[model samples]
Target: MQKSVRLKSFELVAGDIRDVDVELLHALSISVRWPHRPKDWELFRRAGHGIVAVDGIGRVFGSAMWFPQGDNFATVGLVITTPRAQAQGGGRWLMDQILEQCGNRNLALNATHAAYPLYVSLGFTSEAIVYMRQGEVQQTLPALPTLGGELNELPSDRLTEITALDERAVGTNRARLLALLAKDASIATLSRGGEVVGYSMRREFGRGFVIGPIVAQNAWDAVHLTAVHLKNLEGRFTRVDTRERDGVFAEFLQRSGLGVAETVTTMSKGRRFLNREDKNPWVYGLAGHALN
Candidate 1:
């Protein structure tokens, strides 16, 4: 039997991401060691538009997706290129297609180390560093700050109640994306004087549940908001993506056993995506790397 054979290179073409099989997309992500399950891929497909690089035989080699939030902003994610294609500039080609499709909308993305230079060269400037924290939840959570307001679980149908608060933190109206996430998420809101002040959502993804989109007025508030979900998730695998590099909130996460697993740079192509203010609602946790 022949030990090896070199195959000739072939032409590739752009194809609609929706037209590809979910299993193929799953395989593509796995090739790059991404943690997206097929369900996650389906959720992404439903939330945005994307394109895939394919060959004559319909094999997918790469993919790039963009989720539009309102008319002026979008987040790019799920950019992947098979090992065999990366050397040939497949990643850049896929991103070019996404940029063209995005039109005039501002863009943001969480860039892995390998892709950082590519995004920078394409005009994306760094904004912040997101720590990808994950681990088995500690059996006993660290002592939380004194409860300052009512922390209540909100029915997903009442999603509208928190859209304004969400926008205040995210800097854009992502009600549509939040509605889709609500379909499978458990939401909690912190209210003071009958006014919602902070919120968090927990949903299944990748290797476990992710607690995110946590919006709050301070690190203490962020701690309580996240603790509400952690209390119920003890001993389960969980992840939280946040730009809180250091502070009470970051300390809480670290002490709770959700150590930093990796870090990604948040890059933007147009208007600034993050505008944080002291004592104002800010995103303590992100919705997702791609959705940010």
Candidate 2:
């Protein structure tokens, strides 16, 4: 594989799995239809870090892209295997290598029903419940926190600070992941103070803007930031996803006016990142659809 990565078929790779080739990934995305394409897959790897699993022929049969939540904890999932390459441990091999790669770090991942068993076999347990709420942009940012707000275009420096704050809100640092999302022309943010206290980045997914990563200092902050962000984009349809909010920001959106929508499980395996000394929970928003 290494020798072939040096070859023409697979040698066209660049950056990391996060941002390798949107076209290639877009091709792969067709394979990931059901749950929708989680923005972080494109964004996380775009942040300029991830593990690539290339076949000797240079085809990316399977890969797991991960971005660190901070210096210590890391959320590493987004395991993918080509449709032709599914089963037969192709996906598991990619995950195994990622688990080994992120051994000591507080690793997190979002698992699908098909792969949940693989994750459990690897020592992961369920973490949170993800709720998918679909509706028009409510056109309201709920009253909460500082209500501090600022609009930001990615690649702009403010996102850097917001990325840090987002980690604090979510307990995992993923500067690399946020960086990835910034590449898309549509990525943007809203902050309170000089610092980026909250943010929302979305893409023209399907019928509307699929709200990928929404972060803030708290529940209200996150929801507020999301509302303000969405209201700005008129005429476009929208869907905002929320993580299971049982922690400090328990059922935040439940009050934010988002209905139950649909439910998805945030599955995990291996060592968990709880209220440990190394990991801190400042999670104002979710890292991505899966892990983080």
Candidate 3:
């Protein structure tokens, strides 16, 4: 539990997610027009440390979260402030609480163009561009690729492999979060000679299913992995948030019926930590803008 700090008429409480009212948090999200649903908020709470600002009347006005990735890295996200709370120091106070909790670890986040200045004021610099794409799946999509590796359902026994590959690709140890996601998400893996080479996971999120965290050796392999995940979702709404560098994969998604919806700039503070070794240019897609 975090000590509560009083600021003007508001109290900044280190979130005890179990006790923090999800309904209140959901209401805050809706007030800001954030896409996260109540279930998504639960997932974030379960996976990270958070802080919420409550007014004297006990209404949630602002919220922020930071997911620890290994010992030296963390990702901050879900920072929101009610319209009435904006420009009143609530957002900055929430950010300060999460940063203080994160200590000296490197921090990263996806910031909207509107919020980019605030993050820059906190010493963060743009690292990459992330685009959110979504649409109803087309009924007549191109056939899945037959080349590259064979795609199959990710086996429970491959948890170790999944974590290792994810760390190498994403530059962070998120085994605990991955474990939780695996339980509720449909995951597919591409294997060559019985060794897993790439993977993708699709799960119900927001308005529909979101396919992401796609990790692969190259653009082609990523397409293959993503195609396998999309095959089962034909005619259903699907969303994917991908990096701008993965333009080919993004094009493929656009061709398959999804359209670019919005863009966010990925920013980092302190030293950049994502490993992009040539052996495996892995992070073709992110788990989600928030999670990344």
Candidate 4:
């Protein structure tokens, strides 16, 4: 059931995200200087479910969303509150509602520096630092093939293989989300001996085209996949959000024309963290911090 709390001047009622207006969510994100478009909110609505806090006037004041990786894990994101609603406990309230819906499943979220302490108070611990890179693609780069693998466009027949690799790399079965992304994005894959080993997805995003969730066998393959994806995006705006641990790939992105934009802490409050294994870590880039 939805919850409600009373403030000094207005009543804050929690309800389903479907009940909240997408324009209001977009406005709330923009009020905080987030670079999300209405389409982004639509995408979130399709891939996950969320809760919204509405004021007495039926205006949305805060929101929170969670994408279930599977039965055992989920990722929470799109947590935002209007400036006027901050410190009134709306943010915390929305978080509590999301947690309630998640039950006892492990949960993960990326937190901004300002919001870091708040999540910590709720039992989330910082795990990794993620960096954002964005800029116009000024140069046309050559396709660098991965060793033992050839770079090519992702074939529709390889969806199963891609989803399997993604589940292993991201700890989630996002086949639905991946299918939607693949339909609208230019996908590049690295194949070895008729098997797809790595892949990258690039498509129009906040500012321009964003390439990510670049799952590859190693840094070399990751960079190669990235190059292949970028070759077609030359002279266009592009962005990539990558983990700090991908030191080599991060540096490569910098040299490729994208500049560091911001960094956020990846935090989790659960029994497990995504991509915790070191063996052939294929998640070189994330789909987005929100989805990761």
95-153 per-residue lDDT for model 4 (tens digits): 88889899998988889877787899999988888888888775855344346678788
- TM, every model: 0.96, 0.66, 0.92, 0.92
Q: Which residue runs of candidate 3 sit more than 4 Å off their true CA positions? A: 1-17, 143-145
Query: Cα lDDT of all candidates, in order?
Result: 0.91, 0.56, 0.81, 0.81
Q: Per-residue alpha-carbon lDDT of model 2 for 116-235, expressed as tens digits? A: 788788877787766666555444534455555666665544466566655565656566556655556355566556656556676655456666676554555555555555656654
lDDT of 3 by residue, 137-241 (tens): 887776555567688887655678778888888887889888877777888888889888888888888889888788888877888887887878888999888
Candidate 1, 1-292: lDDT as tens digits: 3111112385778888999999999999999998889999999999999998888788888899999998899999999888776756778888887899999999999999989999998999999999999999999999988989999999999988899988888889999999998999999999999999999999999989999889998888899999999999899999999998998999899989899999999999999988988756999999999998
TM-score of 1: 0.96
Clashing pairs in 3: none
Over the full model, what C-alpha lDDT does candidate 2 score relative to the true structure? 0.56
lDDT of 1: 0.91
What is the descending lDDT order?
1, 3, 4, 2
Model 1 residue-pair collision total:
0
- Least accurate stretch of 10 residues (summed lDDT) in model 3? 9-18
